[model samples]
Target chain A: MQTESKSPLELEQCLKCSICTAVCPVMNNTDAYPGPKQCGPDAERYRMKDIRFFDESALKKCLNCKRCEVACPHGVKVAELIQTARRDMSQHGPGLREIMLANTDIMGSLATLVAPIANFATGLQLSKEVLHATVGIDHRRTFPKYAGTKFETWYHRHAAQNQGQFKHQVAYFHGCYVNFNYPKLGQDLVHVMNAFGYGVQLLEKEKCCGVALMANNMYNQAKKQGQVNIDSMRKALQGGVETIVTTSSSCTLNMREDYPTMLGIDQKDVKEHLGLAVRFISRLLDEGNVKLVWKEGFKKHVCYHTACHMARLGWNVYTLNILRQIPGLELDILEQNCCGISGTYGFKKENYELSQKIGSTLFNDIEATNAEAVVTECETCKWQIEMSTSLPVINPISLLAEALDLEATQKANIR
Target chain B: MKYNTVIIGGGLTGLVSGIQLQEQGQRVCIISFGQTLLHFSSGSFSGEESNTDVQALLKNAGIATVAGGYRLTPLGELRPAALTLEGYYHSETAELKEKSFAIVRLPKYLGLPIEFLQDTLTAQGREVSIITPDEVVGCPAEVILVPACKAGYDLKKTYGKRVSLIAALPPSIPGQHIHAKLQQYFQKIGGTYINGDKVVRSTLQTDEKGVRVQSVETQNLGDELIVADHYILASGSFQSEGLQSNYDHVWEPVFGVDTNAPEDRTAWTALDFFEDQPYQHIGVLTDEAGHALVEGRPVSNLYPAGHILGALRTDIQNLNDALRIAKNL
Candidate 1:
């Protein structure tokens, strides 16, 4: 069954203002892809008249960053229209590379079992070339290294020891990146939450948030994953999970906004439960629910790269507010620009150069700051910034974890 | 969550005020809904000639501005513009009073109609000639007006100061350029900008000293409240939806602040379309302190600026009021 289109009224609202074109990062970087105004509402009008005119490959170039949507004063769902066009165009089937990128959970789980070998093989230039020739992954770009132990595995073995000690409970939705590539981020999140006397429980069964799938035009597969994740989250909520939390800003955005808007999961209860999901550390700090005792003399001058998803999600303020609470940490909030990795978009061979170009401004700004460390919430952004700059890029939770008095927490854990 | 000041718009006023406050060592955050009216602005600010302080402030912020004057519109008719960016040609320096100018109309250019522009210029007692861009190689006319199409190419460099750009309509490149610069400056000065978040409703704290806003609820992020010591409501006028009106009454939706408007609907619009309309004056009523009123009483910590102050042409008045209020704070 086809997913219902969001709204034609939204398409009609476009005044051909070109505001979307002005703000679109993808358009600003490359001429190969027509900007959002042309691909979104303008092409949408033609697609409504004759579906045959929809260009799949051109629409595929869209980063689905939603900057265009935010820039539209008339409230046109410009990104949605482009996504819809791509969905309709890809009705036949997606490519093998698209499928592999979309099902991150499956690849991630398999890769984690033999992570050291997998990481080494993917890191090798010849292997990357072979993979690129066969599977269309970029030859130059480095894939995120899979963790030796998945976050779920580590949580069950180690962090779950003090689960029931706290009254306030949160079901953590550690997205595919944290679960597979950087389980340490998830572990840091757990430590930070535990420091605040809140028990962090993993969702019983969670799938990939399908941001990659949606961008790659596998809308149906993305929707299925969305449903699975929604079901898992609902089950957790039924079991007395007060709130659901995600360490990844993109995952939080997917659950909160894209589930209903893009995936057509219009159930009122599920939507309400999805709304309860917040970016883990930022929400805790924003609500003043977390009491943090920073380890004295933990000084670091860090520059923050506001992830595109985090900026669009409107939670960068919370991230900034939380970061300021860390004693002796100086922060330089970098100018807002797309780091241009944009999940898997930067991973494809065709997009590699454009991605780097788009991210040039951000890289220059970071280098100019001469920051000791770069902090960002999205794992993809962390990878992108780290790859672009020599500086170590970390999630804000990791910084919080570093400053956290884990010894005091262990003493409390002993009780 | 709490800041020294929380600005509720990311337009010129909010950004400028936030930047000024941040430079003063105050923690500031701007909660913006989306692309502001700055995207539609004509890339200039106009008002009373006495407003040099704000112009100097803009200059300090790295926005080069020239003296206020007239600029040619897309129709070739001159319109009043003040304190324009350095690159734009102004009539104050152009001296177009009795000059013969050529309008370079590009081929298949979808912007302004050439005939209409010719008519307007001809009616204005100026000699006008229409020519394609290539014909400009040996044009006799000393001055030329071209569409602001060439992204970064300065027409003045090739054609000298005699070349001026016709003001494009909304979603203008010049406007977007200025907006990005302002936003970049704001962030550079240590101000936090929260974009794509609408201020839904505000929480009011009531005590013996009357009422003050405690926090504001945003559309996204469910129950997370944004707390600030002071608030600036520069959400803009009806075009930006800072003020909302139904068939019966107009109201400030966020804080439910009292508006200064005629209760009767008939008083909304003027009989003459070109004349000043009462509807334009419908906005949040503020006291001398620029604090928005709740019923008849002023909310101590809440200040109103920009178009939300009513009838004031935002381009003319926003920066002046924003800087003045920001200084007083």
Candidate 2:
């Protein structure tokens, strides 16, 4: 057996051009970050010489948005450099705020058990203030409310019985956001897939994709959860699941890219098997094998917000392409800007101000669009945009579910 | 995604061709892998007198340009540049040999060739003077020139209309500016740009129209073949990864288009660094219409533009070639 490597351990490929620095939204908004150049490759050169060369505080300011990686002409894994540095730093056990944010599955389960009480308490202004002072979550931030029913619980009860009747089966990795905060998105994915003649089932075992855990600097926990996710996806693929589609871009990115790079988990076999829902659907549509029937008079002036992870994933085009099919959908794609909410980073009081400042550019763009609602593939961006702007943020899959003709789609895609 | 045109590479040629097609009411998409050679540009463009047609298109996109027969190269010589960014020095390469120039020098911003510039102009039967940026007000030269290095911001803004600038080495801010501007213009005009994504393969169909690319799939979009009625391979040279090589052979990676290079890889380069290498001229073989070829046959809908057009390329006939394709269609 090959000994596992924990980090990407990539060589230094920075050209010292500051191009990454120019694109870094955090550096443009705040001085706390020395920028991606200094934070990633530059710091990496020193980190190799001695452990103390690692500057923890400044590196913590990185949104880990992967914008630097996307902008680098030399293809330097700039974000990987920053993440590996954070992963290697002497393990200070996670703090109270970090623990509360990082333990998504645990917190989500407990919150779902008492979802109404949790939502009420979290939404209450007085309770928000108390939690802000105690737990360090920003009082201005509104936590995405827990659902009355978890997606997995609802999936097993309502959808599981009907899934076996379909010939084509695929597993769905509805992440923590879809599992706890919104089961409606998971149900929508099921409906959209079923309409296309594909049955969506749950993975044999699913865990949080560990995006929040990694952002919280809980790398070890993130690794364990990443391995679990990859293993589950691999097993599902082995069981002849065509692919695993996710409603969350972050979960898809984390599973396909971050797992191998950040956690050093072997996901090559299952990497291509996982993607956002639109990616799979759009591919089939492009090949002219499957057809999606659209509803009549389903009109809405909507704009697509390319979340940072979705941009980094470079799959926003797939989502946008699928959305353009709605006959009356006057689709306007908003300029890509980071929403500054990199997982749980925006909820922390310290980053709350910087996060909002960085996201203001995007919020301003949204305000100018006069769009009825905002569509994005990332749930965190949904939180950030909804909190900052008056627009209700939605997933493309959710919009497609509404726009796709149920009876016509089922008939058209029956072949 | 389906479109009227799908062009690989979002560099100068790709964006220009995309913008031209987009303005003509064709749905266009340009897929770029990493940052293009645009980041390495002088932020200035050089072409022929005929290039003025395409120059006007750039002007509509908020790009400011001036045309002279020639432009000031980084090495302090005049070269024929069809279109020049406003605020950059230019001259008639041979006809206007008498105009004097004032090359501005700033401490710690020693990106310019101070001695070579003065000597070359003096050799060219013209008066050349070295002056500080502050002396631009009283300088006697016809043009106040500065190096396009990152000493500060735009020279024209600081020193007024008399000011001009020359190209710099890689990672020039002005280069990035123009690239960002053109890309923004392309997107603004409803052309979808897929940055940081590369076309990995093509689904080809050959009929009476020749080998047509039915669809082109990208790295990020995997098996999702982006179908287009017409395709353009503006994806740049070996440096930009439009073409790649191993010890065995040199080939175009994206479409496996036919490339012209020395059979022996050993003859690809020169022993000395300064010498022009054979590999530099190596690129995809194209038909008269500039469509890229596969297995020695022209792909009907696949048009090759920019540096991928090989030694025939006249940077530095990029706009002309792109305009040629756009105008033909």
Candidate 3:
């Protein structure tokens, strides 16, 4: 069943308990924020009486991390309230920077078309300064580089021929990050699935998960993308695809949690299929349906940074459990800390400093662990952590791919 | 999906118990409906003062407790309470009776009436002075009673423990502070907390010995069954809906545990509104082992704690009882 819609009367449920402030990462880092208690249900009472009572800038400062929602004893939907307020306040439409960042699929496609020039241009100081001045993207941050070939294109050339031959079938919803920026992760996902005797194919025509769009207050665009993704996923499911899996935790959470709850895609079949879209590694391990053949002498020290949405989705344990299976691989989990690059929120020049400040704890923890490399489930977290630290951050699936004996899979692929 | 223990509420008792169980290396998960009643707490724990064991447990959880001999209530009358996160006005001993106090009132601050406080303090044979400060900083009074505002301003930092915050009308600051600390402590020790979901129904297994809870189902998370070896029902009293009363009778809603209450509906409340009400003590009666009983038979795996234990004066007894039952577990 879907979660009941929170009514205006639910605002009265706030006991004025300032408990939300204590656990709020944003409040802990900066004094500029009035904390979720004040900005959410507290201000909501006033806003209900008069829409003029809204504080547009203060509301934007929220990371929408849902830490406040978790800390709230009364189920205040503090993050949802802040997001709704941002949506209502931006009724006139979002700024140019927001509009640009929200459309990841378009930018990703164009960037991949001119991969070398785009990657080189993003690295140059002069280009960064010019882009910052024009588009409000922070100059100091390093943009994720686009692959020479997108995942969909690579899949057609390499992996698509082997589809439908395996005993198990899983439709991969490779969100824009894995599709354009890190196609290797998508390839790794396919290789790992194929090694387990499961055939992997891309969803018929998936769109961006729309997490950035929803965060940027582009509700209509997010809804459209959600509908398209759902339809594509439904088509794949109808064609005997057993499960829908994703490499990114944020994208998985968007389909599993935000779609029905926030985006109003509550059709019975859609909800059932959405339930099938489990975290890739967790589902495989939990069902006990696949056997992982760990390569002998494969060992490394891996520190995991649990992405906020992954933790909220309750898949961090799954990631940890699967990673720990590697023999002699010493795993250290960083404290539950937000990476602070929440979709497009951290990309803005105004939020660059706050984003870094919020992520500093995670960075320091990673450095302290002295792990050979860092692993996380969310691509946004991967980019943020890698940019902030010297260690290379990779997905768990990529790490899993490395541990597999690729000779066996390559032989199977040749057959 | 499976844990060593599944605690029903996320209030002070449920959280504390969860932490204790997790420390014992049990996989614990706390399922909560929404806002805990602790939001109405005055941040004070008042009970049999000699029970240092419970106080030690609280201290172990990183919550510093002060003697808090007597503190002025919102009604202006002084009452005995054992407070946590003590402000300046909350004295550990009765020496506060001899001290000169100034009640500072801020403009447009309607939390506490200065005249009521003055009258109550004067009635207690203490001299009281009232001042309306333009700002809380640089006040001349040795001890100032200010509004209970914790955000945007830190009275303790500004006035250095000399300023004691009074409980505001509703969302109490001290209560919120303690609740946050408890939650953080519980999580730090590897306890899982699931908020914003209510346990709609529980699957029960009956055997020759007795009945035991097999798994619990929640409202929002569809089709996911939360299975635990042991279940702790700390859902609290009427405030959080642990115990429900209709025109005919009172009963625990979640498990339908038999409640200890007067059979007559007329005996539920007292004649005076300020006096102790009988219904306040009506809750799930438990066995000597703290296992909740249904129709005079104990559910071997179900243990009841906190306000749901049918104790009188819940604020005083909930924590102590919770600690006692949780330690034995």
TM-scores of the candidates in the order shown: 0.86, 0.82, 0.79
Q: Model 2 over residues A1-415: C-alpha lDDT tens digits?
A: 4332233444444567677776788987876789988888887888888989888888889989988877776678888888878887845777899999988889999999999999999999999899799989999998989998999999989999988878899999999999999899999999989988998889888888888888888888888888888888888988988989888988888888888777889888888788988888877777787787888778898889888888888987778668765789887777668998888999999999999999998999899989999999999899889989999988998998899897799888776
Model 1 agreement with the true structure over A1-415: per-residue lDDT tens digits:
4233356638866767687887888887777889999999888878888978788878888988888877676678888888877766666677788788777899998899999999999999999999799988889887889999998989999988888987878888889998899989888878877777778888887889888887777777778888888888888889998877777888877777777877887545765554312255566566665556668788899998878888777777767767777888888888678898999888888888999999998899999998899998888888888888889998888887897786575445444
Error of 1 at A74 (Å): 3.9
Per-residue lDDT of candidate 1, residues B109-141 (tens digit):
566677888887788777889887677778887
Candidate closest to the true structure, highest TM-score: 1
Model 1 spans with C-alpha error above 4 angstroms:
A1-16, A162-167, A266-290, A408-415, B23-26, B69-80, B91-94, B97-150, B153-169, B188-190, B204-214, B246-249, B258-278, B287-301, B311-314
Error of 2 at B46 (Å): 2.6
**Cα RMSD, model 3:** 5.5
Distance from true location, Cα of A37 in model 1, Å: 3.0
Model 3, A300-350: lDDT tens per residue?
Answer: 898877777775665554565576567777877676678889888889998
Give the candidates in order of lDDT, highest first. 2, 1, 3
lDDT of 2 by residue, B87-199 (tens): 66666564445478888887756556787878877777778898887788878888667887655355567766777777765566677778777887887777888988877
lDDT over C-alpha atoms for residue A379 of model 3 = 84
Question: For model 2, what is the error of residue B127's alpha carbon versus the real structure, in angstroms, after optimal superposition?
Answer: 16
